[model samples]
Target: MTVELTTLAAIVAMAAATVLTRLSGLLLLRYVNFSPRSRRALDAIPPAVLMAVVAPTALATGPAESAACLVTALAAFRFPMLAAVALGVATVALLRFLGL
Candidate 1:
C-alpha cells in the first residue's frame, strides 16, 4: 500500500542520514584538511545541533516540558545522560500526575 511504501521510504531516508553523519568525518578528511580550530568547531557541532533541535520543542510545548528540560539539565550535572533522561521522563510523569 501507499502508506507502507511511505513508511519504508522514511525508514530508508533515516538510515541513510544516520550512515552519512556517522561516516562524515572520514569522508571529509579525504577531501579536507582540518586545522586545530576547525577540529574544535567540529567537536562542538553535535551539541549545538542537539540544542538547536531540542530547544524549540522543549521551550514551546508547555510547563511540563519545560520542567522536564530543567530537571534533565540538573540531573545531568550529577548523573550520566541516560540517567538524566530517565529523570526527565519521571519528572514529566510526576508533573502531569499532579495536574500541572
Candidate 2:
C-alpha cells in the first residue's frame, strides 16, 4: 500500500472501532434489563471514572497539585461538579503562579 492508502486504511479502522464502541453500549442496553439498583450503579459511572482518572495523577504530583485535588474533591462534594472543577483548577493555577 502507498503511504496515503495506508493512512486512509488506518483512519477507516479507527472510525470503525469508535463507531462500534459507541454503538455497543446502546445495543447492550436495548437487550439487558437493568434493575433500579443497577441503574443507580450505572449512573455513578461518570464520577467513579473521573476519580479513577484523577486520583492517581493528583497523588503522584507535588503538594500544590495534591492540595488542589483535595480542594477540588471537597468542593465537588459541597458544590456543583463544574464549580468544583473550576475551583480546583483555579487553585492549582494560582499556586503554580506563586511558584509553589
Q: Which candidate should be chosen as best, given TM-score against the real structure? A: 2
Q: lDDT by residue for model 1 over 37-66, one digit each (tens)?
A: 999887665545544555785879889878
Best by lDDT: 2
Residue pairs in collision within model 2:
none
TM-score list, all predictions = 0.53, 0.67
Whole-model alpha-carbon lDDT for candidate 2 = 0.83
Candidate 2, run of 10 with poorest lDDT: 44-53
Error of 2 at 65 (Å): 0.9
Error of 1 at 66 (Å): 0.8
Encode model 2's per-residue lDDT on 1-100: one tens digit a residue.
Answer: 5569888999999999999999998898899998999998887666566567679869799888988888887775567677878898999998999988
Q: Rate the local accuracy (lDDT) of all candidates.
A: 0.78, 0.83
RMSD for all candidates, in order, please: 4.8, 3.4
Q: State candidate 2's TM-score.
A: 0.67
